[model samples]
Target: MSYSIIAAELHKALQDQDTALVETLASELNPADLAQVGHHEPASRMAVLLHCVPLDKRAATLGFLEPQEQLAATAGMPVSELAELVAHMSADERVDYFKQLDRERQQTLLKALPPTVRDDLLKLARHAEGTAGAIMTSAFMAIPAYYSVARAMQTLRLKGADVETIYQVYCIDTSGRFLGTVSLREIILASSENQLAELMTEEVIWVGIDTPQEEVARLIARYDLLALPVLEGERLVGIVTYDDAMDVAEEEATEDMHKGMSIGKIEGGLRSASLLDLYRKRVMWLVLLVFANIFSGAGIAYFEETIEAYIALVFFLPLLVDSGGNAGSQAATLMVRGMATGDVRSRDWARLLGREVFVAAGLGLTMALAVSVVGIFRAGTEIAMVVAMSMVLIVIVGSLIGMILPFILNRLGWDPATASAPLVTSIADASGVLIYFAIATAVLGL
Candidate 1:
């Protein structure tokens, strides 16, 4: 169920003052849903839910809450309660929760925590946000390669409570260098006498701890993995799960969608962010485009004398230019989306470009013929020829432009989505108008 349903349940339970109902229901819900419920309601109701659930669940569940709710729930938590929560949290989620706290509160939590655990968390937090190191949880299963299957199984059993996943177990040498990986099924299927090194598969792909999360996600998706090993200066640091990588992929998609629509990144969740914030993010692009629109107007005005000489030319000018822009926008949008999702890569540029050119030529010829027929019927033979010629030229030019803009943007280290519908259409509008008027004036000898 959505947060709305949870909120309704909580509100009804609260009015009934049904503590047992609340506790039982909250336990049944997933952390995400619970977090959303806590976010929708205020501090008073939230505290009750927190008190009822097992403290570990409360802490883990709190990780899912918005930054404001996180602060509200934990600001008054006692030293003992808070320490348990921090201890129970996975390293990445712990650091994320700590990051939302102010400096003074952070110090208090650090003071309460054991020095070793505190240091580990602070070290993890030191990584720049949105990197492999930042996203990876320190919770992982590892064993010495020389350890027997029975011993390795024992270690996994002991550590499984702390680690997020137990499927991929990294094997290390005596010096802690990463040696290989073993799956749970291997351990179960292997003879108990065999050492981890003997059973482990050495051909494993891993990412450097410093690798950006985007690249990590790309690699994981490319390789089709359940988990990827993380390295710090050739030493195994941790592992990032495919689940986490999927989250990164979703974020990348969202950012691209924003750019495609000509809006910059929004600071918070789309539903919760303020109207002013949304407007502020979107207005800069609009203002820049407004100034750019003037340049387009200038292109139109440059051929003002020609338009006056051949008054009939103005009638089809908009139609010709707009059609070109629409075609380019369609092509650019498809190419951009393909590139983002890795459906169309730089390597496929040759094939994609060839296909687009053929399609554009065919479309231009067909469109020109249709426009020429319309022109002949609407005006006369002379004007029809002008219209037909301009139409073909504009469409051909627009088609090439549409196919090229995305590639150029990608090569320039900008997102291809930045060459979105509005921007591409705007370019086509300006360029097509210029091509149309220039072709018309020359053909008519005006």
Candidate 2:
């Protein structure tokens, strides 16, 4: 359905005080988009979703909701509803929701779950966050190798409703030992009398529960499979589907973007972030950035005598310094993005730095020449050459600094993205100021 149509219908539903109509309208919308709009009208939206979406779809949609929306919307749901939702939820989403609740709230929620569902939740919840164990979904289609194609189909029809993917079925032994995987298509094409053991392929690519999400995504993408099984020691615990892999990729990218801006754990996207919340995340870094600038000013102030003698330096300072900041920002942004996407890594540092340095030199020279010609008109021949060379030197350093900072931070167990944007710009700004004055005093004979 079109967004405008949904919006118009929703407006009428609100006016008529028809909760059922609101819920009906919500059922037609995609969960992600529905969640986006839901964040806009917390109380009303939550009511629509809670009332409109059936248990399974609601559980799936809840996984896509912003963290704040999850909290507020699920607050009033009955224990039965919560338990049913928990049964259908992915492990990562369940972990995030459970962690948000207070101790009392968590216990109450846990107590509400069915015995089997509660057992799976507790098992998943026990795994530490930010690991393969935490991100995997418990729902998967696994059958013993002895089952015939017909039996497998029966089993799938019975349990596939709750699984992440039924298109790819995993074959295991009676011991719950993973044997291999078989596609539903292949199974369907084969004789119904054929044994699953005969249909199953021997090459089963699986991930250990402790494997990182990156490796999991990479494995899924590389093999181009619909899903990969997660094993605990030997037994299959869960599976990570391609859709889940995509989620991990997108999340890693978004997290890197947040790190670039020094955002400290603000969830639910920018819309849910409060004024105080934003201020809290940004203030500490801004203060450190402010202090860093003092040195830049000090570099200029210390050379006040030089500036007084060569008034020409003061005239061109902004141009040269800003060029450095801009150049550094470019190189830093590229390196940070490349690192995040896995296009570049620690092993490529030397090659990347070498390329950036040469590129920086060429760019610096072009900008310096243009500024020098303009400076000659503004400050005469000697001062123009001094200004040009200062810009050239600073820009080359800026490029090198940009390339190195990200690598160094990554080495120190910090996200390379944290070194981008304001952090790199501020560092370049201070470095540029000193380079500008130093060039004037030494070369212009100030």
Candidate 3:
């Protein structure tokens, strides 16, 4: 059923205090869908909605809520109840939820949690945000290196329910240092008498705890890993599962997209962001671009005599300048996305620039040819020459500027996406004005 219908039913159930119907509805809906329905309810009603779900489902549904909604839904919930909900959560998710609470709430919740869970949450939370350690979960299955395949299988049967994944089991030494990895497939296929160490793949690929989350995602994607082991000085601490890596990839892509549009990093995203928050993220770039356009105006004013002499030059002005801006925006977008995907790098700039110059020249010539026909019909030969020549040079300059700015930003330790469409187009517009008029003055002999 649609979430709107679910929301309606949920609201009615809550109003009638129909505990049986509420539980039935909660069981029928997925945790994510349940969370979506909860989003439609007021904060006061959200806690009640949560309470109607089974305990395990309640924790899973809470995980699906936005951080603010999570806080709102659980507000004034007893510490012991809160602890039980948190305890049911996966290790990584538990740490994330705990970190969202206020300091006092966090302390109380931690104290209410079981000792083992509390220590695990504290260790996971200690890792800096946006690192492998922060996102990795400790709920991974690890077997003793000395265990035989039979023993390992027995261990999985006994303890696998408590772990997140069992497909790729890790092998560790007595001191908990990572020894290697054994896939469940390999273990099941091997003779029961074979030692796990003998059956395991010793060439295990792993990342350090401090690795950037993006790098972790890249590695996981590159290797098609179910989960990548995280280590702290040879000791296995946690595993960054593919699902977590996918989340990092999505967040990074969204952040880059926002930057591509000249919007600053928006906290909590558009739906959750306040009006003022949206304004703050967008206004600075737009206001700066407004001031930047003044340079385009000044370039026009500087060539007032040329414009007056050949007023037809004014006819092609918008067409010519907009062409440059559009071309530049296209180029900037390609370069930005290329750099983001690691398809392009700083060292490749020179080689790419050489190719870009040839490519831009061909593009400029083709555009110049297309516009020259309009130039001839509108204002005859001299103006056509000026317009055509201006198109070629302007396009070439714009394309080069678009292609180079991202590299410059990258080299300066800034995000290459900082070379946004508006920023590139603004610079191109200003340069187009100067290039068009300067070519007009020379070709028209004014």
Give lDDT tens digits, candidate 3, residues 27-142: 77989888888777777677887888889889989988888888888997999999999999989989989988889999889889999999999999999999999999999999
Q: Write down the RMSD of all candidates, one decimal each.
A: 3.0, 2.4, 1.9
Best by TM-score: 3
Q: For residues 1-446, write the lDDT of model 1, one tens digit per residue.
A: 65567668876886677999898778777777788777767777777788878977887788777666777777788877787888777787788788877898888889999887898889888888878998887778888999999998898888887787898889998888999999999999999999998988988999887898988999899989888999897678888898889888988888888887788887546855789989998998888778767867998789889878878777897899888988988888789888876789877888988888889888888998999988998879988998888777777778778778989888888878898777877888888887887787787787
Tens digits of per-residue lDDT for model 2 on 311-397? 767878888878887888788889998887678898999998889888988998999889889888998998888888887888998
The TM-score between candidate 2 and the true structure equals 0.92
Candidate 2 error regions (>4 Å)? 84-92
Q: Rate the local accuracy (lDDT) of all candidates.
A: 0.83, 0.82, 0.91
Arranged by TM-score with the best first, the candidates are: 3, 2, 1
**Which candidate, 1 or 2, has the higher TM-score?**
2
**lDDT agreement of model 2 with the native:** 0.82
Give me the runs in candidate 3 sitting further than 4 Å from their true place: 1-20
Poorest stretch of ten by lDDT in candidate 1: 265-274
The Cα RMSD of model 2 versus the native structure comes to 2.4
